[model samples]
Target: MWTNIQAKRPVWLAGAAIALAALAAYHNSFGGPFLFDDEQSILHNPSIRSFSTALTPPGGFGFTVSGRPLLNLSLALNYAVSGTEVWSYHALNLLIHVLAGLTLFGLVRRTLALPVLAGRFAGQELPAAFVIALLWTLHPLQTESVTYLIQRAESLMGLFYLLTLYGFVRAATAASARGWQVATVAACALGMACKEVMVTAPVVAVLYDRTFLAGSFRAAWERRRGLHAGLFATWLPLAWLVATAGGDRGGTFVLTPEAFAGYWLTQFEAVARYLQLALWPSPLVFEYGVTPVTAWTQVLPYAVPVVAAAGATLWALRFRPVAGFLGAAFFLILAPTSLLPGITQTIVEHRMYLPLAAVIALVAGAVMAALGRRVWPVLLVLALVAGGLTARRNADYQDEFRLWQDTVTKRPTSAKAQNNLGRVHFLRGELPEARQRYELAVSLDPGSAQTRYNLGLVLDATGQPEAAIAQYAEAVRILPYFAQARLRTASALLRLGRPAEAVAPAVEATRLLVEPAEAYFTLGQAQAMLGRPAEAAESYRAAVKHDPAQAEARLNLGIMLAQAGELAGAREQLGEAARLRPQLPEAHANLGIVLAESGRLPEAVASFQRALELRPDYAAAHYNLGNTLLRLGRVEEARGHFTAAVKAAPDFEAAREMLERLR
Candidate 1:
């Protein structure tokens, strides 16, 4: 019994080492701020605010959680534990990545221990699988999926993908395969809900069975037809998700034939780059923005090598099935993203989250074959190198400024990187530097509506209203549905005091904005400035309806109602406005005016005093307090307030007249 337990020690030790390596490599990443798409997927995602909403996910496409309900639900769970502290989100992401690494270790060890391959890997299975799993887990290329919080979608899907295959392997050797088969199908379905990439797992599972267990496709299918059927049925939910998403995968995919051709051409270069990074793992980029390879000349050089590899993979499928499986897995896992035309990013490193395992396994297998049992030193060096590089990569994510700066330094031409760096600068209140970066971003990608809008915001904040309006107008021209740009354009026009010119963009903004309370409020201000009282009141009411806590909107609506002789309505709006914004002198002053008009003299005096406390020099508050006091027959107090109001505002004719009458 002691000997038997001792025999299992190495396997248990290898699993613990892989988990420890994952935790050590990502130790610094817990403090990494939410970057880029994390803003929409985890930080501001209303769907993840509750379990029910998260299970439904959001309707929009560009967000990470758009149609990925399982991914959203995971985020919701993290939120329940730690809201937006960010550490909890990073912890969950690292946990998912570590789980995937252990699953890969199990799958590789089990596959190598099978009868077909066991002869070559008999005593080396544990060591070889440990090296592959450790290197893959600590790979610098994985930092994007592990450190960048929103890409939890990638790592989480990868976990389920690995589990599906690992479950199948367990089922092949188990006496009762029913439970393992069900678990495999369940994992596949959950993976589909995490990301669209899991669509290839079923095919990969059948290929694994043919290569390692059954020795032929016919036998594999005959033996496990029910299991394969269950696996394929998992695709049904993915099909429904893609169908409901309009097959575009949330604006990331483009289906035009021309787009498909261009994207396919670009993949040759992208695949070649991924292979290079797999070996060297240096200069791992965070964002490789869309660079369409329309001309064949740009793709031909990379295409030659990639095409040769594909031909080699096809050749190996007929002769050397193990090599073929590894090659096929790499290509198959990436085929969905490579074939699909994703407009957001043409080449991203995170797509290698699972494919890296295939690459590492293939390379490690080659080393073990060449060196036999002497491959230990080489594997150890590789593991140490990969772990050190991953730790260094995680250091870049510690500061948002540093992360985007690193991307900008590496990919100077990536306009999206430049725009993000500018956003970090903007958030830090470094206006001049932010403006400079945004201008460079706009110059790099003039057609980018987001970059144009960002530049307009910098210009608007710097008091260049006309220039800001021009940028906003250009953004709207590029993307007509950009409500923020339209709203900014109207805001710039309002700043320039061209209320008539602001009206058009403000109206368009109200139509296009999702939460249009701000747009409605902007339109109300424009209408009021244009002397359209009824239109202004309608716009203010709409703003209040969309966002009941909009104190400024309620205050404006109250003033409008009081002017139109609707005292009761004015009193309600003004009271709520004051309650919502206790420090706003305007809200309390307006409420006091309506109270006096409604014959609430004592309440009116108290409101006026509170407004004066917030703003001692508020001429209007002093004047109103004086009027309310005079109505209460407190003539001495009324005289003192009138005198103070006249002193505060020399142009206050009404206060001066009241003071003279009291004297």
Candidate 2:
């Protein structure tokens, strides 16, 4: 029994068993409408919001850091069908994490060349791999990376990272056995399609060859030179070098030589930061911001030698200790994100997600190798302690408010954290608090479009439409294709009774395919107010076609259809809209209009009652109900609704018209 339990497979199985246990401890993101980029990432994201849109070339879904069109296409598929259901998104994230966990295990097991067989009968082989992957899957530090729906880029990107590494392992094995290179090439190509971040895979492969493939350095380098060159040649992922992108294009700082120097200096600080977090992670945050580092003078270049020498020393000193290779692997994988110029922050905990496995593998392997006969007692205690810490850490990610609030508390200087905290206040309708937070955010980051846009929203809520308009306008001026900014501006114009002035920009917004349904819906409302019923009807029809599930859009479409004398078509649209959103007062009210217009007075009265049930003070629903009742000679019922309508909106023209007739 002791002999069977002492093997590599047993350890892996034990780790997997622990991970599976962790999954059941709490539901993944059990409640969330959406958060952060989920708006564009899941629901309004054009890639996912539209069908028949190409994902490649001049005009495509290019809202990515890695220029990965296929990943965007898949996410678009997620949005189109699932439509922001938290469970669906959570489930998908969970599934990807699971696959990644399994893949990590596979990669580690294969990389170690552990002697194991595949079967319940055969049992676990690579115990260290099992420990590594297990630690990876259930580590609390990784909860945000795996659970945040919008951070699909992190998890999915890491997946390709693993694939690229795993492919290198497979290629090395095949080469050793004197097999074909096709599998290796195919895997690398697939990794690129998944994420351009895997561009470092070739360099990693070369190092991996030197570290693990051969017992000696010179032989391994010789074996992998051709493969490394081939991989490097094919690794042209980031073809463009645009400095600023996304909404408001507050964009990244310019990459000047001085900036480059600061960027390089940041790597040492980041290296220290990551190492610190790896040992004792605390005060985890979603946003490290555009300024996570300070400018570095030439005097601050001390980190270059420290990190490099430390890594070099570890490599040079690892005669028989696998710890050297493990440490080296962690540094190699993490170097790109850490050493790069473009990443917003100088340090992030999630950046360690891909590399943590190396630490786990090394530590677990040491434990196994050192105290081979008496390892069980030590391993058990370590698992419990690690698992406890992980569980405690994950509790923070239960919701955005808690997470962001904690972030600000922990890292008060984090402007991004402040902005996110303010967003939480705004989303929750704490307007005064929201305004205060937004003001703080803007003060901290004057150039941030996000903060400025948010400030505009708060201003609009306080009835400062002109100021709000200016902010939104500024946002658009900075970020020419910001859909939310465009929509906000157009909606503000409509509210300000300048609906005609709202049309062209709204149309342009739709033309840019930035939330086309929202732009069209808002444009339809503007055109309707401008007395262009025909044009309004066309816009509303497009809105419904773009998002059939939008009850409000369908309600507007039905009203327009009825006005255009298409009663049957109008009724069908409104009825479906009402059925889709039984709680929506407008859909029921619109259904009543189409029903009454088609001379179905009794049915129209019922629809109006449903509308009033949802929104008792809805003047249009009350007015329409009154009209229907009056038509049916029910003076008493008609009088009640007419009175109700007049109270709901005293100055409402339609309500006034109905009440006067009823009196």
The top-ranked prediction according to lDDT is: 1
Candidate 2 Cα errors over 4 Å, as ranges? 1-34, 46-66, 69-138, 174-182, 214-259, 292-328, 359-380, 561-663
- Per-residue lDDT tens digits for candidate 2, residues 1-663, read 866766555655654675574565325454544666565545555555555652541222324422555556667566676766676666767667766777788887776563222231122336656666766776666766666666666677677667666767777766363242455555565566554456666766666666666655678667666666656665654333111122211333344677676676666766666666655666566666655345455325556655674666475546643566666667777766655575346666667777777766766765665565366556656655666666665566667888888888877777778888888888889988988887888777776667778889989998999999898887777667666777889999998999988987798878877458888999999999999988988898898888888878888878878877888888888898889899988888888888887889989989999988888899878888888888899989888888888898888877677666656
Looking at model 1, the pairs that clash are: 61-250
lDDT by residue for model 1 (419-461), tens? 9999999999998999999989888888888889999888889
Top of the candidates by TM-score = 1
Alpha-carbon RMSD of each model? 2.7, 6.0
What clash count goes with each model?
A: 1, 6
TM agreement with the true structure for every prediction? 0.93, 0.78
- Lowest lDDT 10-mer window, candidate 2? 241-250
